[model samples]
Target: MISSPERGGTVSTPTLRQILRDQLAPADPRILCGHDRLDVPVRWVHSSEIYEIGPLLTGGELLLTTGLGLRGLDGGTRKHYVHDLAERGVAAVAFEVGRTFDEVPDEMVRAGSAARLPIIELRSVVPFIDVCRAVNTSIAAREVDELRMRALLDDALHDDLAAGAGVAPMLGHLADLLDAPVVLVTAAGALVSAHGVDDDSAAWRVVDRAVAEVPVRSRGRSLARLVVGERAGAPTVPYAEALLRAAAGPVSVGLTRAGVRGSALAARLVEDLVDGRPLRRADLETRLAGAGVTVGGPSVLVPLAAEAPDPRMADAAVAAAAFDSMARSIVDATVYALVSVPVGGPGDVDPVERVASGLARSTGLGRTTIVVGDPVGIDRSRPGADASRTLTDSLRRCARQLGLAASAVSPAGAGRRVHTAREMLVDEAIGTLEPSVRAELSALAAPLAAHDERASTELVRTLAVHLAHGCSATRSAEVLHIGRQSLYQRLERIRVVLGFDPTEPSVYASMMVALRSLAAGA
Candidate 1:
């Protein structure tokens, strides 16, 4: 048996050339087999002990011997030996001629080859150690070449990151490097930008929406996502999604660098503007444009300020790594930072308020209220004046809704915007209100909801749904597949218990919202 550090164990089935290479010069050509370069590492053995350790040997280990090892063996016995060795994961068999049975054994060769094991006979004298050394040297050189390539890649990345480059230039550069197109998206799945020209909106939307949410806190920021384009004719969407997600890291950083330069400068300037306290949008735009980001689009500017749950970078690093792996697996974008903070500035309703409230409820942060400003659209091409004003106005509004210290953005907002706290919660609240009322009504309706002896409860539900959909008796009758008079009678019974006329528009709206909210809460 030979011990291999790579396998972390002793291998019983050995390769002849590898054993020779380990103990001798690894530069000799005598190790060549079938006119092909012998590249596999292995150890040699001439003893019958090969059978005992065969099962433990992973394939690719060469075996060496002469006829003396199997002298006097019958055809059946020899075939069995060769078969057993092959079954044990032996890579090849080498027979040294001129020792104990000179001519090649047809049975052994046939059996070994049938097992896909390369069996060779030495035609002339050759030093085994020279063969081993040759293979070892070649392998060492190959490893060195691989290491050099890896080093070159690392060096390039280090240089790109050193100067605070953005994700766009980096994406464009990578696309150039890979000869492919790249795109960056917001977590909510909006396309931030793309490198190439093939516009498959469907594919883009699918990938963008499927990406993981980057946990972040950006005031009034929409969620951002990252997407990578697949090569033409790619058959699998899932695999393609994963590939793009894996590529998002570098792409995200690239776009961020390209987009934030102006924003960062503008941010500093804004601090100054607010300090003296007379803000001119144009001045801010000029400063922002100088930093290279256009502030004119219908983009909302969201200031990110959230204290991390764990102050140590260690937790952040772990989350980043997890997010990276998840991005690779799910083609989703993610962020590693706190996404909540105190509201500042004019009475601005911090959008993150909703997310915080939900998270707080889910995580026990406490009762929270949030306010949000309407979305401000930014034209991508003219990304200066309009964007800056929109952002400023939105921030001011956000400050008002969320209490002074209760407002904040997600940490991930450094890159992009997601839904604000109010939008998310209002939507949540709207969804659950009505369903809950109906369920409470369900107990009242249990005798009624379940009382179908005359199908009165079902008729009532149908009447309600129809009235909820449209108060027309004709429409309700058509929908319920019943006569108009039967619907009227059901409505009367519903009114008796539910205590509201379905025809009253105001009453209907309240009932609808209540039912919808109740359902949503469920």
Candidate 2:
């Protein structure tokens, strides 16, 4: 996997022949070698009279010297100089003749010829600075042109992807453009998408022998890499490294699109899974496994509900990436995540809580409530239909929790939080009571509601808020955007109408049940 020297090697720049022909040099230099081989790119023009300049150059430079180092040097030293410059990939050596020798040194020319290095003899005095200025300006112009070309290419690739062309097709197109087999592998070396490589093994072999590898990254995360040079006989791709680097943006966009599509499909499957009508066990197992949801295991489903335009998953594409391989779907404002929990695995923490926290942090979702249901273990030995019935019941529980999560989640300010349905068991129990019992409980808040309706007061809201804050007047005031005195005034009104103080610990449980029961019906 010998990577190319520079990632930006595809840029078109001024070459030695172009520099000489563009009248960038003065006093017509004599070519000591055949001028046909002058295509070496001149990255910069450096005027170094030191003989030890070989170690100083990073390569791809056109060296301009006045024969200062060649003075009193033998043939062996001169030959060493020629070979060093060639090894450094110096475009060409232009030696100014007047300062050190009357005629160009014969041994220098012969040594350059042996090394297949281009040598230019400036017979008349030449101003190294003037030549450098002209050459470097052209170099800058060519660089600008190359950058413009890369931008145009990237834009075209992005447009094609946005039009629904997938990553594989784009990679194939890139392989054609670069004239090499290309591959993209994950950080774990799994093949993500590729083109021109024969098969999976061949693709990995291409990775093993990568001639150029460009990292594909987005949103400050590295997702994968592009590997070129698939086979020994493949024509060398022009600017292979530069083209791969340019393609990184479009690659990330393509991968994001793919992830979002998978999430969207998973969401559809989840909707079906949660529906009242059960899918056959075979059909359910196939879909669940495809989405990375383990079948025949203890399953815990967590439903995350938020208001429309949830800040956490604003970009469904990013949400898809953040969830990794989890089976999650964004249905309306709620995200349903189906998790497979190992028996007695890890600590008491649920996987959904850990994942939801990360998802919230990554999406900048200020608040999220994930109501987790009891884990249901599917008996694989049972009939397929029976097993699917068990899962369907669990999913139904999941569906109900989504609604409960909305009504049950308490007012918690701005950070990652996870709440389970068990925490709201009393509320759930009250809501499920027989209609007659439910009616009696709902009556508890009727007085406050009636006062609110008649006077346009927020007595009912204040009661709920106060109860949600554990009967703390100070915290309720802060949440209600009121002063302590104003909150106390509302509390007094609530106490007068309801015939009991909501702050009494003896009646707190009854008050909570009444409020939650009313909210559940609402």
> Against the true structure, what is each candidate's TM-score?
0.29, 0.37
lDDT of 2: 0.65
| Best candidate (score: TM-score) | 2
lDDT of 2 by residue, 308-350 (tens): 2231232352353354344655432234555565445656566
Each candidate: how many clashes?
Answer: 95, 0
Scored by lDDT, model 1 comes in at: 0.43
lDDT per model vs. reference: 0.43, 0.65
Model 2: runs farther than 4 Å from truth? 1-41, 45-60, 67-93, 98-152, 230-235, 258-326, 329-522
Judge candidate 1 at residue 95 and give its lDDT.
Answer: 66
Provide the lDDT at 246 for model 1: 41
